[model samples]
Target: MTSDTPARRRARVFSRRRSAPSRARRRLGAAVRMIAALALAGGVYTAFTPGAFAEDNVQLSAAAQEGKALFDNSCISCHGRDGQGVEERGPSLIGVGSASVEFQVSTGRMPMTRQEAQAEQKTPQFDETQTKQLAQYIQELGGGPELPEGELVEDLKTNPDALARGGELFRINCTSCHGFGGGGGALSSGKFAPSLHDATQEQIYAAMLTGPQNMPVFGDNQLTPDEKREIITYITVQLQDDRDPGGLFNLGRYGPSTEGMAIFLVGIVLLVFTSLWIAGKS
Candidate 1:
């Protein structure tokens, strides 16, 4: 074997040095690829995050924003910041829908005095426009059934059978608490059925749809929209605006009890007159 020389050793050292750099280069390339994969994974996770999904879903309209301001001012105390409501103080406004808000606020039945069996109607805290704004806010918080725009009652002027149909519906469904004349009546508790005299078509329709207070929900499944409007026409046009036809006394329109009283009084009066006339003639 040839004796080792500085030149040969130096050549071997040079080869080793070159090979070291190549190995380092391969390690660096692997590190770079690993870092790039991590970054891509992070980006994909963020794109699919729940927070991102929520942000996309939270878009609100201008009317809803205006109503939000009003809700924050007046309704936040009981309803909470997001209208989820305060336990024992108020119920959730989210998912209650605009129809519920309109029925309660428009009819002056909300911002209640105290929790009871039912809420009573008073002068509304907000006017018509403000009430609608509040409804908009509540509607956007969590979606639910909405009132149909435009006239609540369909045109029934030409329908001769509309009044009769309405009266029949009212008697079958409404006469239990509301009297036959639409006068208010007492309920099981201190609560009472309110008079329909002052109720507008919108209020009536909203009440039926939302079932405000102790009232039961009469959804579209229970009463079709046409049937609801028919019921309203009967309440507003026929019952509220009845006339004394045939020139007979209506006797307060309380039906058989009032009629029996009137008959009894007239019979007594006639008998007394006849007896007095016979005595004088004899």
Candidate 2:
């Protein structure tokens, strides 16, 4: 074989070095492609698999289940299976929450005596625990408004502005039927929207949730829970601050009509008595 030229040998060595780098680059690209493929596979697998981060199921207690069964059997005729109520028979129990259930059941207004214009309070059919279970059963059936934990009544002192806001809300919503000063009003039927003067915060809340008798339901969608609390505060504060100057018993704050009647009857009797005293002295 003839001896190789210096230029030719140098050219061959440079080509070999360039080819080695090209081979290494190809291997590196293949490795990156494989890694990407593996990552995509992992993502697909996770998405298809069940129970990855599933929500926990709500569990009912035995009593609640039993109550639900009883409700279905006895009450569902009027109340509906879902407790949304029938059109003419019963009102929706959805979002009325536990407080209303307790009040209605404990007072024996529920499991009604008959379909009447109003349900009168009487001896309770269910005990406290049973009442609570029934309430829970209704609550779980169709989620609606619920009472907050701890005390049912919240202190209005926490937010003074709530009272002001509540008054405005009351005027807009309740004043039409309950009157401007919480004096109850007559309804279409013999039913009346009872005075708020004697109602507590919880009672007011329950009334709003339950819609009691002829009153229309104010669901959370219509009036939020916070707004309900504010309304209660406004009513309570008004009742507490209303001090009568005449030392006369105010008949549920019926305003001018009752006041005028009282003055006419009592003032006439007093005037007659004074005239009799003058004649006796002469």
Candidate 3:
């Protein structure tokens, strides 16, 4: 009887040990399931948040959609499906703001006559509202530089100090292509940077916003709208205000080359005339 009892006890102990592993495995599975559920909830929360997945659904107005369709049909052949132009055709419109679109389209320089050295103003294809709609569409497609919602004209007097600030901004921003004095310069190919001498405040603002022709677009991100206006103020008020001591016929403000030519031609003509008059008198 004692031997039988000892054997039975040992067998019972073995069975209990074997069952422990099964219990542990069940617990582990439950834990894994709990962890997976928590992870799924976290992922759901992140996805629904603003700017997380919302950007994908940014809807355009009806006008913008129409404009986009028009752009895709008419402009995209050369400008590219996404407004990133092909080499030597159009430039990337990624950041070019509505102001640029408005200027180019409204002025009739867009839907270009042909690929040329520069696009000159002609009869516009779209009316004012359509132009604005196109601008809005482009603005929405790729979030970039935008014209301020309210009035475009800013209070020039409030930031009178910005003129000096603008001077610095101009030197850094405008001087490269427009030159230090806003005289403008030549670009690659036959394209030339148009002189700012004749540009009005709105025109300059529009140009900075639009980046017409071979000029690369400078978005508000690249140069803020306020900074743009300040630049316009500096160029128009300060630079344009300062008059040349020399009379009309500023000779393109190109300095010595033009002056030298004028001196040689005019001086030679005067000398020859003076000599002829003296000989006639004798």
TM-score of each: 0.70, 0.58, 0.58
What is the C-alpha lDDT profile of model 3 across 85-106, one tens digit per residue?
Answer: 6788777666666777877787
RMSD vs true structure, all candidates:
13.7, 14.3, 8.9
List model 1 lDDT by residue over 94-167, tens digit each: 67789999989888888887888888899999888888889987787776668889976658744768877877
Candidate 3: lDDT over CA atoms? Answer: 0.73
The local distance difference test score of model 2 is 0.75
Residue-level lDDT of model 2, residues 134-206, one tens digit each, is: 8887776555555566554367645779878998999999988998778778887667777677665666787
Task: Give the TM-score comparing model 1 with the true structure, all chains together.
Answer: 0.70
Q: What is the lDDT of every predicted structure here?
A: 0.80, 0.75, 0.73
Instruction: Point out where model 2 deviates above 4 Å.
Output: 1-59, 69-100, 157-160, 180-183, 197-200, 220-222, 240-247, 255-257, 272-282
Best by lDDT: 1
Distance from true location, Cα of 81 in model 2, Å: 6.1
Judged by lDDT relative to the true structure, which candidate is superior, 1 or 2?
1
